[model samples]
Target: MKDLVIVFPGQGSQFAGMGKQWFDGNRVVRDRFGQASDLVGYSLADLCFTAPPAEVTRTRFAQVSLLVLSYAMYEVMTEDRKIPVSAMTGHSLGEITALLAAGALTFEDAVRLVKARGEAMESCVAESGTGMVAAVRMPVADVEKCVEEFNSGGHDVQVANYNAEAQTVLSGTLDDLKGLTAHLEDRGAKVVKLNVAGAFHSSFMADAVPAYTEALHEVEFTEPTVPVYSNVTGEAHESPQSIRESLAVQLTSPVRWSAIVASLVERKAAVWVEVGPKQVLKKMLTGAVGSGEVHSFDEEPERVRAVLDQLVELKKREPGLVGLCLGAAAATRNRNFDTAAYDQGVVLPYRKLQELSKLDQETLSDEQKQTALDLLLTIMRTKQVPEAEQRDRVESILRRTGDAGLRTIAGALAT
Candidate 1:
C-alpha cells in the first residue's frame, strides 16, 4: 500500500463505552482524551467513557463523544507506530478528525469545531424541519427524480446523503420527508427513517452555514501536512483557506462520497482506513473498491498492537508494489471531456455518451462504439447545441462506456 486513507464516522456511531478497552490500557489514549476534555472544560471523558446512555445520546454528547474517540484512536495508532499514512479523509462530522490527523488543525481546533458543529446541527434540527431517511436499492437518478417529484408536488425535499449506489438519504420538512418517503417506498426503495434530529446536508442546512463560516474565521487552519480529500468536490483541497470555506459549505452540501471514491480508486490508493467505533465508513469505502483491503480503528486490542499491522504485512508480501493507473487527460485541454452533466436527469442504467474519445481500442464493441464516436463529432462540428446543451452532450459521451447500442449515438461522436 502506498498511501493510507483513514475514514471516520459521524454522529450516530457514538456509544457510552466506545474506546474503553483501549483507553484502559493505553496511557497515550487516556492522555489524549483528557486533553480534549480539558479543552472543552466540562470533562468529555465523563460524557464519553462514563456517561449514562441518555446523556451520551444527547446531541451535545453524541457529536463530541464521537470526535474524542476517533481522535484518540488515531493518536494511539500513529504516534509511535509506523503507519503508512500518505493521505486521509473523513465524512460529515469526521472531517475534524481528518483535519487533525492530517495536521491541518490541532486537536483543540478540531474539538472546538466539533462543539460548534454539534450546536449548529442541534439548532438546525430544532426547527420544525422535516426528518431524514435513507432509501436503498434504487438508482441515483431515480432517487433524485423521486425528490424532484415530491418537491414538484409541493413537498420541500432533496437528496441529502448519497451514501452509495442503491443507497441514499433524503431530507426536507417533516411533511415533505413523510410524503417523499411514501413516494420512494412505492418506487421500490428499502426506506429507513434515520435517527437524526434535523435534515442535514440539504438546503435545510443553509441557515446554519453562515454561522459556521463565521466560526471558521475565528480559527486558523494550517496548510495540511497531508492532503485531506474533501466531500465538497471529492478531491483534495488546495489550502487552509479553501478548506476553511469548504468546511462551512459542507453542512449544506451533498457529500460526494461516490466522487471521492472514484478519485481515490482512479489514483489506485494503496489501502483505506476507517477510524471510528463502527464500520460505517468501511461500508462506504467497500462501495468504492469492492475487492480492496481496508484497515480500521475498531480491531481487537491485541490484534492491533501495532497501528500499521496491515501495512507491515502488505509490504512484506509485496514490496515496491504499484497499482495499474489510468492515464491523465491528454495535455491538450478537452473542455468537452467531462461526463458529469450528461449524467444528470438521465436514467443510470440508460447511460449514454456526451464526449468524444477512446473509440480506437477494444474497450467498446465495434458497432455501438463507432456510433458514439460519431455523436461526439456531431456536437463539436455543428456547434449547433446551446452552450449548456453542448456541455451536457459532451459529458454524456465520456460517462457512457461501450456506447448505448445506438448507431446514432456512436456515430455522432465523430462529428
Candidate 2:
C-alpha cells in the first residue's frame, strides 16, 4: 500500500504473554526467541510467555523482549506480503525495533545492544532514584511551563515524552514528580505515576547514555531500505552516523512523538500498522490523526491481515494499464531533451494515455493496453529515464495489476 507507515511501541507497552500468540504459532518467531536467548543469556520465550507482570516489567527484560517480539511480528507480517512501507518509526525503545526492521541493524546486533541498553537504564534507575509520571488532559505548553518551574527550582525535572496533544510524560527524581501531582491537579489535569524504573529521557538517564553509546559503537549500522523516523529528531535519519548519534542521545532526549506523527500526516500516510505489544501507538496515532485507520498486529493479527489483504485487492482493482501509464509518466523526472522531438514523442503519447485513463478498464482492448504501455515506455525514453528505473516501474505496475500480458512485456524489458 502506498504511504503505509509501520510503527512500533516502546517501554510501558510490555506485559506478561505479550508475544505468546506469535511464539506459539510461528516457527520463525520461536527461532528468533531462541536466538535472542542465546545472545542475551536468558530464556526470552519464558520471560515473555510465563513471567509474572512484575518480572516482565523490569526494564532489563522488557526492552529486549519487546524488540524481539516486535521484530518477529514484522518478519511474519511481511514475509509473504510485499508491503511498500513508505516509512517506519518507533517510540523510545521501539526505535531499535524499527532500525532492525529497516535493515539498519542485524538481529544479533540489535539483541545485544538492547540487552546492554536495558541493563544500563536499570543501573541508572538503581543509582538515581528517579521516576516518571504521565500528565493527561493537559496541554503540552502548560506541561512545559510546569517543567520549567520545576527546573528553575533546581528539581531537575523535564518533559520526557510529548505523547499527544493532551498527554505528556514528565521524568525526574521521584520526590519532585510526586510534588507535581497537586500542582497538576490544581490545573485540572490528571497525573498518574507510571510504573517505570527511572526518569527516562531526562538528566536522570544521563548515566545510561555513555554505556548505551558504547553498545551502539559496537554495532555496525547500515543504511535502511526504507525511511526510519527518529524519535530524537522527529525526522527521517539522514545517515548511519546520524542514527547512531540520535540513538546515543535518545536516552536523555525527549521523545518527540507528536512531531513524528505530524510529519507522517504531512507525508500523507494512509494506513498505519503498529507491530508491537498492545495498542499503545495506535491510541497515540488516533489522538494525532483523528479517525486514521490503524491496525495493531499484536492485539488483532487476523483483523490486521484481513485489512491488509483488502488493501491489496483494492489496489489491484483500482489501477489498470492507464493508471500504470500515468504513474510511470509522472515518475520519470529527467527532462533534458530536444524540444521539438519531445513534443511529438512524449506530449502526444501522454495525451493519448490521459484519454485512455478516463474510460472503463473493462472496455479497453488488449491492443489499447499495449499501446498505453508503449506510450509509457516512449515517455520514459524521451525523458532520459534510466533503464533500471523504467524496468522497476513496469514490474511494479505488473505486480499490482496481475496482468499476465504486461508481465510478459516486463520480462522482455528485463532482458
TM-score of each: 0.73, 0.79
Query: What is candidate 1's CA lDDT for residue 294?
Result: 67
Candidate 2: give the clashing pairs.
none
Q: 149-259, model 2: which lDDT tens digit per residue? A: 766867677889998889999998888888787778888889999888889998778888889999999999987766789999999886889899999999989999999
Per-residue lDDT tens digits for candidate 1, residues 1-415, read 4545677777778777777777887887788778877877777767767778777777766888788888788777766665555557787788777888777877777788788777777777776566788888898889998888777865677777777877887887777777777898898987888877788888887777777777788788876655578888888776778888888889888887777777767656656778878778777677567556666668644444453675656544531111000111111123443465333312221223422232334344555444444434443433334445544443333322212122243234333
Q: What C-alpha lDDT, on a 0 to 100 scale, does residue 398 get in candidate 2?
A: 47
- Among these predictions, the greatest TM-score belongs to 2
The Cα RMSD in angstroms, rounded to one decimal, for candidate 2 relative to the true structure is: 7.7
Shift in Å, residue 266, candidate 1: 1.0
Residue runs of model 1 more than 4 Å from their true location after superposition: 300-307, 310-415
Sequence-dependent TM-score of model 1: 0.73
RMSD of each: 13.7, 7.7
lDDT of 2: 0.84
